[model samples]
Target: MLKKIGIKDPEKQMLKLMESGAVPYRGVKQKDVRNALEERFEPQVLKSMTDEASLAKRYPGVPHEEAAYREMRRLTDELNSSDKGNLVEDWYERMYAQRRAGSSNRPESRQHQKVSAAEWNKNRPASEQIKKDRFIDRVDSVNIGGKEKPALHEIKSTKGKLQERDKEQFEDMMKVAKAERNGVEARGADGRMQKVDQVVYTLTDPRGVAKNEDWIVDQLTKYRNNLSFEVFDAQGKRMMIDARSLKRSKDGELVLPDGIRNRLGLK
Candidate 1:
């Protein structure tokens, strides 16, 4: 689920973004953060982790031991937070990340006792965990009012399925953003540089991505015409400036967002 959200360090990155003024949707307070997060995640985005740490009561798609493990961990965190709803919410993410980390810390090369296929099937359900590598982040720059204005954009992927057309349309928006950035960069030294706006496209899905070829091609073509792109540093941060307020970076790149630069600390 976290894998499908397409963030290498979602908790950390999101924390940084929040500090940078990317407020939570619907104005979540510290108290509301837990319910907000449960509504936002847990079901789809945190499925993999939640399933891996279950309770003794047994949950569908999750077994007794793991569910029990999760329940125990939950109690531990509650104790640590003194049962404060907000603090518990914060600790919940950390605990979840820690559990995920612990589960993945093992060396995969180690081999255990072999078992018959039939026996393994009957007992191995509790051990199998989903392993996936998928990314869905997008960016764009566009022109507005035909005045060569720039609008930089970012797109987030959801865990659900999407129609190819919608995906392509999103890509088109990014292309426009990139093109708008280019036009502004090419603008003469009139000191009256075209304005640029930053836009965003966030898509959330639960069943994972569904590829759409025609939609992909259409988006690719449209973005090709725009020829717009946002390079990243190591941290998945944007590494370009908006058309209106671009300041050339020492590394021959434009000013980028802090969240992006942090993601790519190399730059």
Candidate 2:
């Protein structure tokens, strides 16, 4: 294209264009942009805008909306904690050296906090760091509508197959559980350990009526004469008790319904 326009060295020309902020596209010149920023904000504010350290120190307790400030504060803490070395210093400098352009006043796009140096230190391997970044970045993208996670792959139940050794270890755990006074350990088909306990029922009504023996006895006596009420019989079957035959116990305690008593084998 440049040759057709009577120009040679198109690559060099493109480089010059990019350097001048004109070739790739007509962007605001660096000088003009800086001048415009200065006109819009105070000098101190402009300095803070470019320098992360200055931004944090200037607005240490600013609201979360001021992400740049928060990021700077976090980075500052990381910088202080790490060894006094070129790697950390260079990392911080490289991070803040770039000028940020704001297209809008909304801060939703900036909510993903940058990866901290501490995180980077823990994830020493570049591959691990890349994976972590991808996970976080993908999550941020979904949250901000920059990207949507595929529905099918969203819920991954398993990462890899459970090894035979893990299965043996789980079986050993179950054996150990058998000797315990309560609770039993068992492995599920999904390779997860599950604890089982002897099941017991207790009424959980918050009104406390279920817990009051006297109240229960009174209610049972009042309902005893009602022939329409049903009760469970032996062999796990429902049966109706004749109102005339539903007698109150001499002890003033509610007698268990025949059906329930049969199920529990209680006299």
Give all candidate RMSDs, comma-separated.
23.6, 28.6
Best by TM-score: 1
Model 2 alpha-carbon drift over 4 Å, by segment = 1-217, 223-227, 233-235, 242-245, 248-254, 257-260, 263-267
Candidate 2 residues 1-267, lDDT tens each?
Answer: 223223467567555656676533346686665434323323232233335455456556553225342332333323222221222223222332222112222112121123333444352443223222211110111111332111100011111233454334323322222323322333322334443211111111111211332433343354332112222222213232223323456875445455434443434
Candidate 1, residue 38: how far the Cα is off, in Å: 6.0
The alpha-carbon lDDT assigned to residue 176 of candidate 1 equals 32
Query: What C-alpha lDDT do the candidate models reach, one value each?
Result: 0.34, 0.30
By summed lDDT, the worst window of 10 consecutive residues in model 1 runs over 105-114
Per-residue lDDT, model 1, residue 165, is: 52
- Reference-based TM-score, model 1: 0.23
Q: Residue pairs in steric clash, candidate 2?
A: 232-259
